[model samples]
Target: MTVVVNHHGVSAADVLTVARESATVSLSVDAIAAMTKSRSIVDSIERDGRPVYGISTGFGALANTFISPERRAELQHALIRSHAAGIGAPMPREVVRAMILLRIRSLALAHSGVRHIIVQALVDLLNHDITPWVPEHGSLGASGDLAPLAHCALVLMGEGWVLGKDGHRINGGDALMAAGLTPIELSSKEGLALINGTDGMLGMLILANDDLAHLCTMADVTAALSIEAMLGTDRPFHPSIHAIRPHPGQGLSAANIFRLLQNSAIMDSHRDDFEHAVQDAYSMRCAPQVAGAARDTLDFARGVAARELVSVADNPVVLPDGRVESTGNFHGAPLGFAADFLAIAACEIGSISERRVDRLLDVTRSRSLPPFLTPDAGVNSGLMIAQYTAAGIVAENRRLASPASVDTIPTSGMQEDHVSMGWAAAVKLRRVLDNLTSLLAVELLAAVRGLQLRAPLQPSPAGRIATEFVSLFAGRPGPDVFLAPILEHARATISGRDLRQALEAEVGPLA
Candidate 1:
């Protein structure tokens, strides 16, 4: 289905579909009208020789320097060329696509004083599968992701390179010509409008938010599997237990665990074991608290993402009454905060999962399960190293979760003294999200192996389905084989045929 961007603005979900699912994109009639009206205002400002901060005057510290009309277009050209200073690894294909889609959506708000053709060019780039080679570095998150967006803007100007449909590198001009598209001729303030916004970090935020939301849900699913494998109890997840501190995410996570473990012979087998401890370890018992809090953190992040989706993050906003104003809306502090918070939340989720993996590998702690779930514990070493892999990622996540927002160095000769290190925050959040995926996969494999060792006694109705689903690619209980293939299967389960989704089909959606 086609997604529309109008004067009223777009939503985060729409961006995801267009960016990730390859949905078709189009500009709204209202958006075209808004852009036309806003563009006319800029023309009038230039005609009247109004010293608009970004229109007729220089940018940043040189805001007082005015440019003549004849030189205005060159100003834009020079602005994009100079600001496209990003140098590092190219951004992920999905992220670049998202950046383009988001920049278009924000422009669709009709406050950036850009022509409709410019927005349409971005749409055509996406429709034609033309992705610019945007770099991974160079954005302060203030002045609206200037460096990252500039690289994107460079493609629109036909001055840079792009990755084609075949994933081959091609010059931006050549790509545009091949797709029957043409480069943009920047107007007064057009370059600034194109490059000034939180699209870079916002794009990453959207992707991370979507991934982390699913990860948080899957985190619960794996935790349930681990709990059962460890002979842990689900009583702590009862609604009555969570009633006093009722966080929506917590309740949802608890309810999910409670339902997933229903009718489990493994849990029931130890239900009346007087010799067994009444409570389980914190890693097993506090699953809901950690996973639910991650869910809640994402809830807040989504709110911010939604706001950014509909916002006009241009440096100087254009109003309907033909007024141009400089504003700080382009700062990415909100997104930076969301990204950092998600990193911390994802880190904690992985941290707990690693603990569960360690317990499963230890013979004494794993109940009756074989050591490392391997037939020959000492000779094979089993999943002993898997825990170490997970632990390594967990420690890296701690560093990724260091809150990039807390520290900022002055840039632009301190003209932008207090910058929001939001771009860094968003970038690291993606890494944290990736690391969490692998970490969760490692835990899933361990838990599935533990459940397999408990064979004769079946898992819960829900657990049985989850285990069976993973077992297809996981193979049966035995000595270690190619662990990468096993982990790949686990990652695919959570990413594609999600264990939670399978349970939801039978028992309904979890929290």
Candidate 2:
């Protein structure tokens, strides 16, 4: 499927389909026309000898200087070459694709005053799968992710490195030539128009936002399985309790849990049984509160990202009346704060998941289950080491959750002072995602094991489906058998398949 880029309106789902599902991309002809008209205005202004920042004049820190018309092309080339100072590991191919799409979207807004040829060059690269090698580091997130985006601009001029369709690194010039493409000579403000934006930060947020949304749904499913495995009371998920406060996420989560556990023979068998009291521990009882808070965090981040995706993060925008005006749409504080919030939300999911895993392993807390859910206590370690591993990740997630937005260091001679370390924040969120995936896998494994012990007493339809899905990958644990396969199976079960979709197909849509 061809994913269309509409500058004014792009959805998170579009990003996921293109980035993950290998969807083709195309830009609208109307968008190109709009950009060309804007560039014509900029050209008319320059022909009449009007001073425009970075177009007729110079860039930041050099804004006081003026360039002669004869050196305009040289100035544009020099800006791209000078800013192509990005270092460190190459960013993922998906992120590079996202950056390309976002940059094109921003230019499509007709505010950046870039030539049509430059926009076409970007679209050609996307269509031909020529992904530029952008470095992960070097963006302070202020003044529009200048350093990293410079690498993208360099590729348009055929001056950087790019991965070809065959996945081999080659000079951008050679790649463009091999694909029957010609290098674009940036004109006037074209170079600045390409690189001067928050596309880098916005691209990262788009990917992270999509991942976090899926993770939120998975968290609710895992929590439901854990609650049933513990035979916990369903009173915590009662509608009356959540109706008083009515936080959308909390109420939605409660409704989901209640639906998942409905018509369970195990719950019916234990409805009148006096195991302890009316409630389970906070980890089991307050699952909605912990997971719902993460849901709310995702909602907030989505709002910020939606606004940023449609914004023009360029400088020296061209007006309809043939005038140039410098502005500050390139600041990344909004994206920075949103990425930090996503990091915190993911960390909480890991934190609460680890605790639930701990409860499943504790002999006293787990009731009839053996210590660490092992068939034999002293002979085999069972899931004892798995809990330790989950705990270690939980601790690391807490450390990764530290807000990268709060800290900043002066760069570009302090002219670009007060940066938003949004790159760091986005990278940390990716780490949290990896850790949470593994942590939840461990919980699912333990929950399945505990559910096996309670067999003959049937689980809810949702829990039954989860049990069968997990059992397909993991088998019943036996004494003196190596558990490496079980752990691997559990990891594959959670990470390799879309658990939420599978459950939704069986139980209908979740709240």
Candidate 3:
């Protein structure tokens, strides 16, 4: 698949294809024409010898310093090399790819005053599967993700490190040579244009938004299974119950649970029994409310990402009338807030899931099920420590939930005072979502075992299919064995999407 880059902006799906699927990228003829037109204005400005913030002068606190025309190329080169100061481990290939794609998208909009070949060079990197080695730090999220993007721009100059298509790290110049490509020299305004944007944070946001949406449905599925395993009522999931208040996410989640539990013999068997509690505990009864709010929050984040997708996060944007004006579009407060908000939402989902896993383990709380769902009782520890693992992750997620956007520190000689810290928020949000995936996997493991303990009483059709799918990786439920590998397999199942796909096949699409 080839994603055509245009000034009209790309969709989140298009970004994912280029980022994850290794889909090649191409610049539209119109995008190239737009770049040519914008570059002329920059050239004209350079010849007139008027000091432009990015064209003829140094950046940030150094903006006051002016450079002669002969030295402008060196200035752009120095900007990329010096700004390439990110620290810590290299970012994943997909993230670097997404950042490159988004940067191209921004430049292709013709507001960044970069040449068409600059956009084409980035396109070549993506097409050839040459991913730059971008370290995870060095952006205040106010002056854009400068350090990270600079690392990427360094690759365009053939002077950084990159992972080749074969997944081996190589010198940037060597990688370019191997791909039969030539590096371009940075020109006036081009280096600043490359590094100045919120592409890194925005890319992470779009990826997390997609992952969390899928997890929301997966949460509903697991919540239903947990309800059946615990002998809880499904009354709370009724469509009418959610209709009165009617948040869109709430209705969708309730409908999913309601359908997942339909034709469930376990639920039907308990319907008439007065012994069964009239109501379930909060974890089971209020599953939709917690998961629903997370879904709603994800929707809000998606909206923010959508708006940012088309925005020009650059300084000194070139106008249609050929005016280059500095603007605050590079600020990352919006992306930072969205990423932080999502961390809280994802953390809450894991928090409630931990509660459900706890209930399935405790003898006093799990009703008729064996302690920790182990038939041998004290002879086998069962899933006791599994609950402990979930608890640890939940605690960690709670700490990660603290908003990174609220904190700020000055950078660039205090010229960039009151930093957004959005890059920090984005990085932490990735951790929270990953933890949520593990947390959900743990819940699925316990709930599947609990359902098996229910035995002769059949689960809902969807639940039975889920049990079978997890069983392939986890093996038949029995006395405790070497559990780490089993748990890893179960995590793979949740992350792999096979379980959800199988259930949806049985019950149709979830919300």
Error of 2 at 310 (Å): 1.9
By TM-score, the better pick of 1 and 2 is 1
Q: Which residue pairs clash within candidate 2?
A: none
Best-performing candidate as measured by lDDT? 3
Candidate 2 structure, TM-score to reference: 0.95
Clashing pairs in 1: none
User: What is the descending lDDT order?
Assistant: 3, 1, 2
Q: Per-residue lDDT for 1-511 in model 1, tens only? A: 8888888877888878888888889988888988999899988988788788989999998888988889999999999999999888888889988888888888888898988888898899889888888878899897988988888888888878786656566798988888888888988888998889899899999899889888888888889999998898878988899999899888888998888888889888888885554889899989999998999899999999888887888979999998999999988899999999999999999999999999999988888778888988777878988888899999999988999998888877678888889999999999998999998899888888888888788988777887788779877877668887788878777776566667899877776
Which scores better on lDDT, 1 or 2? 1
Instruction: Kindly report which residue pairs in candidate 3 clash with one another.
Output: none
Supply candidate 2's per-residue lDDT for 446: 87
Q: What C-alpha lDDT does candidate 3 achieve relative to the native structure? A: 0.90
Which portions of model 1 miss their true places by more than 4 Å? 165-168
lDDT of 3 at 64: 91
